[model samples]
Target: MNQLDIDKMVLRLNVGYNGFKFKESDLKDGELKDWAKKNNLLKSDDKQKD
Candidate 1:
Protein backbone atom coordinates (compact mmCIF):
# COMPACT_ATOMS: atom_id res chain seq x y z
CA MET A 1 0.00 0.00 0.00
CA ASN A 2 0.92 3.62 -0.36
CA GLN A 3 1.77 6.12 2.37
CA LEU A 4 -1.71 7.62 2.47
CA ASP A 5 -3.31 4.22 2.67
CA ILE A 6 -0.97 3.18 5.44
CA ASP A 7 -1.69 6.39 7.30
CA LYS A 8 -5.42 5.83 7.02
CA MET A 9 -5.19 2.37 8.50
CA VAL A 10 -2.98 3.56 11.30
CA LEU A 11 -5.35 6.44 11.99
CA ARG A 12 -8.28 4.10 12.19
CA LEU A 13 -6.43 1.81 14.55
CA ASN A 14 -5.40 4.67 16.78
CA VAL A 15 -8.85 6.25 16.83
CA GLY A 16 -10.57 2.99 17.49
CA TYR A 17 -8.16 1.59 20.05
CA ASN A 18 -6.55 4.61 21.66
CA GLY A 19 -9.39 7.15 21.51
CA PHE A 20 -7.39 9.50 19.32
CA LYS A 21 -9.28 12.22 17.42
CA PHE A 22 -6.98 12.74 14.50
CA LYS A 23 -8.34 13.57 11.06
CA GLU A 24 -7.11 12.57 7.60
CA SER A 25 -5.36 15.92 7.27
CA ASP A 26 -3.29 15.22 10.34
CA LEU A 27 -1.74 12.24 8.64
CA LYS A 28 -0.23 14.43 5.91
CA ASP A 29 2.81 14.91 8.09
CA GLY A 30 4.96 12.10 9.49
CA GLU A 31 3.03 11.56 12.71
CA LEU A 32 1.60 8.20 11.76
CA LYS A 33 4.87 7.14 10.19
CA ASP A 34 6.68 7.80 13.45
CA TRP A 35 4.02 6.03 15.45
CA ALA A 36 4.05 3.06 13.12
CA LYS A 37 7.81 2.88 13.30
CA LYS A 38 7.75 3.03 17.10
CA ASN A 39 5.13 0.31 17.19
CA ASN A 40 7.03 -1.87 14.68
CA LEU A 41 4.30 -1.50 12.06
CA LEU A 42 7.02 -0.25 9.76
CA LYS A 43 10.61 -1.32 9.25
CA SER A 44 13.67 0.79 10.02
CA ASP A 45 14.28 1.28 6.32
CA ASP A 46 10.70 1.77 5.23
CA LYS A 47 11.13 5.37 4.21
CA GLN A 48 9.04 6.16 1.13
CA LYS A 49 10.59 7.51 -2.04
CA ASP A 50 9.34 10.64 -3.77
Candidate 2:
Protein backbone atom coordinates (compact mmCIF):
# COMPACT_ATOMS: atom_id res chain seq x y z
CA MET A 1 0.00 0.00 0.00
CA ASN A 2 1.02 3.60 -0.59
CA GLN A 3 1.41 6.32 2.02
CA LEU A 4 -2.15 7.62 1.61
CA ASP A 5 -3.61 4.16 2.01
CA ILE A 6 -1.40 3.40 4.97
CA ASP A 7 -2.30 6.66 6.63
CA LYS A 8 -6.02 6.06 6.23
CA MET A 9 -5.81 2.51 7.52
CA VAL A 10 -3.82 3.51 10.56
CA LEU A 11 -6.11 6.38 11.40
CA ARG A 12 -9.22 4.24 11.13
CA LEU A 13 -7.81 1.39 13.17
CA ASN A 14 -6.30 3.50 15.94
CA VAL A 15 -9.18 5.82 16.59
CA GLY A 16 -10.98 5.09 19.88
CA TYR A 17 -8.60 2.22 20.58
CA ASN A 18 -6.60 4.09 23.20
CA GLY A 19 -8.68 7.21 23.72
CA PHE A 20 -7.36 8.67 20.47
CA LYS A 21 -9.74 10.69 18.38
CA PHE A 22 -8.26 11.31 14.94
CA LYS A 23 -10.05 12.65 11.92
CA GLU A 24 -8.83 12.62 8.34
CA SER A 25 -8.07 16.34 8.31
CA ASP A 26 -6.95 16.54 11.90
CA LEU A 27 -3.32 15.74 11.15
CA LYS A 28 -0.74 16.83 8.63
CA ASP A 29 1.56 14.47 6.72
CA GLY A 30 4.51 14.81 9.06
CA GLU A 31 2.36 14.66 12.16
CA LEU A 32 0.61 11.50 11.02
CA LYS A 33 3.89 9.89 10.04
CA ASP A 34 5.39 10.70 13.42
CA TRP A 35 2.35 9.46 15.29
CA ALA A 36 2.27 6.23 13.33
CA LYS A 37 5.94 5.64 13.87
CA LYS A 38 5.66 6.39 17.57
CA ASN A 39 2.75 3.97 17.92
CA ASN A 40 4.46 1.32 15.79
CA LEU A 41 1.67 1.53 13.25
CA LEU A 42 4.31 1.92 10.60
CA LYS A 43 7.71 0.33 10.10
CA SER A 44 10.09 1.66 12.75
CA ASP A 45 13.76 2.23 12.11
CA ASP A 46 14.67 1.93 15.79
CA LYS A 47 17.61 -0.38 16.32
CA GLN A 48 16.64 -1.20 19.88
CA LYS A 49 14.78 -4.44 20.28
CA ASP A 50 11.65 -4.84 22.34
* TM-scores for every predicted model: 0.42, 0.38
> Candidate 2, residues 4-50: lDDT per residue as tens digits?
77876767576536545444244666866666656655432454453
Per model, how many backbone clashes are there?
Answer: 0, 0
lDDT of 1 by residue, 1-50 (tens): 89777766866686568866543233444766566545544323334431
List where candidate 2 sits over 4 angstroms from the true fold: 23-26, 29-50
| Top candidate by lDDT | 2
TM-score of 1: 0.42
The models' CA-based lDDT, in order, is: 0.54, 0.57
